[model samples]
Target chain A: AQSVTQLDSQVPVFEEAPVELRCNYSSSVSVYLFWYVQYPNQGLQLLLKYLSGSTLVKGINGFEAEFNKSQTSFHLRKPSVHISDTAEYFCAVTPTGFQKLVFGTGTRLLVSP
Target chain B: EAGVAQSPRYKIIEKRQSVAFWCNPISGHATLYWYQQILGQGPKLLIQFQNNGVVDDSQLPKDRFSAERLKGVDSTLKIQPAKLEDSAVYLCASSVGLAGGPPRETQYFGPGTRLLVL
Candidate 1:
């Protein structure tokens, strides 16, 4: 089984400021990592995923995450954020051969003007 | 193509009452999933269906929760004699399934059904 941990529960940033949401995971086997964003009362949308080949993966809405195997971390980062970027983000992990994903408690991002 | 759809965006019920949530997966998709998301937490997978059969339901609380996919198109999830702890958002997701390996395909989700137990 795989599990994920998001370090921050809430993050507040000003518009145009850079932000990073930290995520770490524990899995005994090879894993696939993903980041998803959820707006208020809405379903989650895929941000990006780290399956293989590249450690740095980019996704929609100018978001990117890096997979560090040694650290077991897949932290999401954006060079500049917008008010529309404010939402809840979740990190998830699925083992190499598993179909289901185990998710981390979401981190709320509040981008202010 | 339309995204996944769910019914009864919100519902309120007293303890011990029964409630059901419905989901319609995207066209041509062969895999479906249901998850329970409690406040202040991430969504937890309750069950997974490949076509009209069960895939993985190890985490499901069998005594209180049951789900089915009829005709492999629409699915329904029910909770019997609900408890206060059962108040949460129920999410439905679907993905395309291929042969010969794990279904590593990306999934699309529907706006969840929020349930409140009083």
Candidate 2:
């Protein structure tokens, strides 16, 4: 019963442009993908993960995410963005062995300048 | 190193009163977590611990919520009576191993505690 679907609640991008923060998931089994980054008050950090190797996944400050598994999706890219990169972005799912995670309802990232 | 530790970063209480929150982890981290963010949503896993027992708390809300980690590296989370949807933001995380294993560890957060149940 996993679920996550961040279709962008807000994304104002501008500091250097180039951003993408969309995510989708539904999982029936076999899953483990993440991307987190809260900033305002803090708590939540870990910007890359896709356990099981190689679907892109780059994380940390530079940010990157791919893992498309037939379009279940896991988007979160950033070719150029700064202004501190703003914050608030989440998309999680866990089901491989279940560490329990199923989030997705965030995507602020308002980095203007 | 020194990452997960939370305690009253902010609180405002007012609906039926009663509140408590505290956490400290990341020194070997045997796994610990408690989340509940809700100001826009995303972060919800009320309880989970593996060092002091309790593998998962289902969804936590046992009557009015309550948590404890006793000796597994400090932890507490109580919320009797309060409800304004319980306000939000109460993260605390840690990770190292031992909970169904396989080494996927990566959960280190803590700078949250903003509860305003008015």
Candidate 3:
């Protein structure tokens, strides 16, 4: 079984400021990592994924994440944020051969003006 | 491409009542999944289907929840005698079910059905 942990339950940042949401996972086998975002009353949208190679993965809305295998972390980062970036973020993991994803509780990012 | 679709954007029911939700996966998608998301929590996989056959359902509360995919296209999930804890958002997701394929890792999700049990 696989599990994900998001250290922060909520984060507040001013517009144009940088931010990082921490995520860590536990699994016995190799796994794939992903970050997803959900706006109020909307479904989740994929931010980025780390299947293999190039630990630094770029995603939409100028967001990126670094996959640190040794640390078992896949933290999402953004150099600059906007008010519209406020949303709920989730970190998910699945084993190499399976598609069942285990997700973190969530991190609510509130980008303020 | 059209994304996954789920019906009844919102539903409210009393305890001990029955409720059903429907889902339509993306065209050409072979894998469908049902997930439950409690308030302020991440979505948890309840069941997964690969072309009308169940691939995984280890987390589902089988005593009160049941789901089915017919003709490998659409699916329905039913809960009998709903409990207060059953109040949550039900999400439907779909992905290509090819083993050992690259893009199979991505799963598109629907808007989800919000169920509020009183």
Top-scoring candidate (TM-score): 1
Q: Write the residue-wise lDDT of candidate 1 on A1-113 in tens digits.
A: 67899999999999999999999999999998989999999999999998899899999999999999999999999999999999999999999878888999999999999
Q: Candidate 3 at A22: error in angstroms?
A: 0.4
Model 3 TM-score, all chains together: 0.97
The TM-score between candidate 1 and the true structure equals 0.98
Docking class of 1: medium
Alpha-carbon RMSD, each predicted model: 0.9, 14.2, 1.3
Give the per-residue lDDT digits (tens) of candidate 2, residues A1-110.
98999988998978988899999999878898888888899898888888887899887888899998998898989899999989888988888877788789888989
Better of 1 and 3 by DockQ: 1
Clash pairs detected, candidate 2: none
- Top-scoring candidate (DockQ): 1
Find the 10 residues in a row with the least total lDDT in model 2 chain A. A93-102
Model 2: docking quality category? acceptable
TM-score of chain A of 3: 0.99
lDDT string, candidate 3, A1-113, tens digits: 78999999999999999999999999889989999999999989999999999999999999999999999999999999999999999999988887689899999999999
- Per-residue lDDT of candidate 3, residues B1-118 (tens digit): 8888999999999999999999999998888999999998999999999899998999999999999998999999999989999999999998887866423367889999999999
DockQ of 3: 0.63
